[model samples]
Target: MSKKAYPYVLIMPSVLFLLAFFVYPFLQVFAQAFTHSEGGLTIAHFETIFYDFNFLPSLKNTLLLALVVVPAQLCLAIGMALMISKMEKGRDTVLYVWTIPLGISDLAAGIIWLGLLDQNGFINSFLFHVGIIDEAQSWLNYQNPWAIFAAIVFAEIWRATAILLVILVSGIGLIPKEYYEAAEIFGANAWVRLWKVTLPLLRPSLQTALILRTLLAFEVFAVVMILGGSNMPVLMGEAYNWAFSYRDAGAAAAYAVVILVLSLLFTLFYLRVLRVPKEAQI
Candidate 1:
């Protein structure tokens, strides 16, 4: 087929899929957000989702979790990638062990953590045997924000780090042996070689890891609900409550749109920071 014919043929499936699955639902949600039985073409749904104090708290909580988790994941992933790349044996075993959590369901992980943090849970049982405490403390129900934050951090890190690890490893593989060999011959120690060669070479991979992990952290749902409970605020959980519990689809759609916009903004900000040059000099 000609180029013009090929473009339409290549896009036809995607266009059909979008129309069938995406466009119609988006239109419905947009209509609901904009219209009311009494008030026509009003922004009340968005106003409620944004201006409401409850929503702000949820939004704030989400941002806080993402900010804390994303950077930590990237750092840990970098270390893991470097270590795995340098390993002469059992590298596959270590990679499998680390990524095993990726296959574990978020809800299952939450339930597992609940058991660990519960009153009569294994941790408490062991500590009691060791005479560490007279009774089991409420690790999950602690009034301190750090308690919930810690659980969120743990869950996010456990599940998401593998994605970064895989991406980083792929990037590391593309860096030719000659580059690292050259660095070694220049009297560059392991740390120096990592800084000058590995880190620079991994910039594109770093950007991808950051963007994906950051967005997922922002919208963390099942684990948060299971570990932290609905008493605490997180954007997606709050949106679920609005849509299902309260039967407010408009508000839920508004919240979803807000999250989508925030994700796009973050991507733009990261691209600006990376500012990848045309030449593959890195």
Candidate 2:
């Protein structure tokens, strides 16, 4: 093959895989979302979802969860990454321990939290034994929306912060030691150096991690289902309900499209806010 053609050939498998798995399914969903079951294109599916009682609450919950969880995770991950970076010993062991949650599936994480938060579970058992409460409390019930939301948030943060930690740690490592040395020589302290030197240089990695984590946050499902159940409606849960429980493919597709649009808009926002100049990339 010609040199120009060889590059395309090298990427052919990936392209074909994306076309078959991603592009094809996306087109199918888009068509189902807009087209009437019997014939030509229509907006009925969108209208149905827009009019659904659950739609607004689900949308709000999804956005609220993402907003709350992503920032908390980002802060925690950055702090952990900095601690690991400064360690003189056992860094690998510490990192391995911290990332243990990464090996646990989302459902498993949710279940583990559920066991702790359940009325009859460890927290209540401990509280009762310690005379903190006269009896077990229904922490995960529909009446305890705050507790339910907090449980899901904590579970998600525990399970996913490792993703950002790993990315930030790698980005910090890529930074040349000379930069630190120069900053130190100029009398820049740790905090000053972090803001002036580290974070600015780490923009690319921040952009990447934020985009990935935000997208995953928007699509959160298994954990929410396991922890909050129908008490906490989210976009993904509503989509699943429409598709499977209600057997309305078009409505499900519309929910999926809403999620896709949100993801795309946030991605563009990150790209704009965190855009690194070509000259600044390490």
Candidate 3:
């Protein structure tokens, strides 16, 4: 092959792989979402899900979860990354300990937290032993929506913040140390250096991390399923119910399309808001 064409040849496998796994399945879902069983194009499936009793609640929960979790995780991951970056000793050990949860599956993380947050679980036992409470409380009860919401949020943050941490650490590492030295020469403190140098340079990574975490948060299922059960209505859980419980493939596809569209919109928003200038390229 000619030199000019070799790069294309190298990427042909990846392009083909994406077309087969992503583009093909996306088109299939899009078709399924728009078609009726009788072989007619219809909006009935969209209407069905839109009118379902769980639809609005699930939508609200999903949006709320993403909004709450993404920002919190970003803040935490940034803090952790910053701390790790400043460490001269045991940095690798600390990072490895923090990221251990990243190796765990969503369902496994949910179950681990379930054992801690269950009514007669470790949390209650600990509190009882310490006399913090007189008896075990129903922490995951449906009647206590906030408690359930908090549990799911806590589990999600603990399990996923490591992803953002790794990204930010890599971004921070890319920044030249001379920037910090220059800031120090100008009487800038650690805080000023962070805001003026680190964060400005970290925009690309922040954008990528936020876009990824936001998309995953939108599609969160297993953690909510285990912690909140049907009491917590999330978009993915509703999609699962439509597909399996209600046996409505069209409705399920509609939900999947909605999720894909939302993820795309958020990706665009992040790219726009965090656009790195040509002159600012690091």
- What lDDT does the true structure give each of the candidates? 0.84, 0.95, 0.95
The sequence of per-residue lDDT tens digits that candidate 3 reaches over residues 60-175 is 99999999999999999999999999899999999999999999999999999999999889999999999999999888887999999999999999999999999999999899
Q: Provide the TM-score for each candidate, comma-separated.
A: 0.90, 0.96, 0.97
State the lDDT of candidate 2 residue by residue for 1-282, as single tens digits. 699899999999999999999999999999999999997999999999999999999999999999999999999988899899989899999999999999999989989999998988899999999999998998898988988999999999999999999999999888998999999999999999989999999899899999999999999999999999999999999999999999999999999999999999999999999999998788
Per-residue lDDT tens digits for candidate 1, residues 14-97, read 999999899988777767777764768878889888877778778888998898888898889999998999899999999999
Residue 225 C-alpha lDDT in model 1 = 91
Candidate 2 global TM-score: 0.96
* Angstrom error at residue 35, model 1: 3.6
TM-score between model 1 and native: 0.90
Model 1 stretches astray by more than 4 angstroms: 2-31, 37-39
Q: Can you list the residue pairs that collide in candidate 1? A: none
